[model samples]
Target: MASAPPAGQGQQGAAAAASPLAPSEMYRNYNFLLRLDSTEVRFTECLGLGMRIEPIRYRESGVGNVVRALPGPVAYAEVVLRYGLATTPDLWNWLKRTAEGAVVRRNVTISQLDNDGATPRINWNLYGAWPCQWSGVPFDALGREAAIEELRLAFDRLDRA
Candidate 1:
């Protein structure tokens, strides 16, 4: 009653022809990640030294409201790395009422910047830092890779004593 895949028709050659793009052309395909700058910063701060680095996943909004079911004017965030240690104590709690709840925004203030470079100095200002209670404080520094590298290096050196 049902027909076969058309013999070798659905085999190697048939599948190959069905493909839209060539293998070599894969690299040519457009991916947003391709545009990510090496200079762009990625930062993450654990509530405590015991907190290990993990991928941050959350429901938030940014820029336009094209997507739905996410936070309005939500921020997926910009800083992109994990912090195992800290130069200063994290005041994530008490700073905002939504610190544990999912109803707040991560407040980040990019106070400093480098007109020509990606990595810049940053300051994480917590406590009333943002409106809806909790918020991830952003960079507030100005410099090139110099300051950024310094901070990153410092974070790596955070050891429990």
Candidate 2:
């Protein structure tokens, strides 16, 4: 009493299965790599590696309703990195030098990894990034969480490379 699938439906499914555009479970967020300057920064969490392009609007001289919008320069957001407090003195030393009026700026690279955590699927390159703020781990007598250190960086430019 059941009817067969429509013509080309099975072929369509097969084609989709063979196409690269088909969705897979390859992409994941847990596996990522972070590098600052030539040294790798170990972080348990990272965020705000993104940019937004502002739009320029052009209005007609005589017409009051029509407005054309054009793309403007892109603006990048600051990045924040969080890691477990440790004996790492390299990052702290660099930050201290910046606080001492050196204003050390370095390039950073964040790479999104595949499910295996080996292959890099995408990369975000940040230029002229300097640590603007650093936060020490909070101490509490009753808290059980691990001590966390946070660093906030401001970069002049960001690109996908």
Candidate 3:
């Protein structure tokens, strides 16, 4: 009395059921990894992955009441990465070299992983990135919170892949 499913529908359903993460499943933001060049670094938070275009307002000679906005230069936002304090000196060394007048740029990739943690669902690539600022972890003997360090990076371009 019931009509059969369309061709390949059963197979598709079986495949989806077998896979741990289906295409319709939304990726969790907390499951992500950061890579600077070839090295993988762990972080608690990543923010400010964005860009904006500055608009130039222009008025035609004959137009008196209308102002047109023209697209101008593009600006990429600085990305801030935070992690619990550790003995890793790579981040500190990079910031120190930059502050001492040596500029070293590297590509950074932030990938959103699936539930499996090994598969990357989304990737954001930052090109020609260099450390712009670093915040040292606050020390308090009475405090019961973990020490956290913050680093800000300035990049020339950002691409989502």
The model with the greatest lDDT is 3
State the lDDT of candidate 1 residue by residue for 1-161, as single tens digits: 96657666767666677889766444321111101112222343322212234444354467364533422332222233233233543323322344455433333333222333343433233212222223333455673322221121111122211
* Candidate 2 lowest-lDDT run of ten: 21-30
Residue 101 lDDT, candidate 3, scale 0-100: 93
lDDT tens string, model 2, 9-64? 78677677677765566577778989987787779999887888999999989987
What are the lDDT scores of the predictions, listed in order? 0.32, 0.87, 0.92
Best by TM-score: 3
- lDDT-wise, the better of 1 and 3 is 3
Predicted structure 3: lDDT: 0.92
| TM-score head-to-head 2 vs 3, winner | 3
**Candidate 1 regions with alpha-carbon error over 4 angstroms:** 1-10, 28-71, 77-161
CA lDDT, candidate 1, residue 137: 33
Q: Which runs of model 2 end up more than 4 angstroms from their true locations?
A: 1-25
Candidate 3 residue lDDT tens string, 65-87: 99999999999999999999889
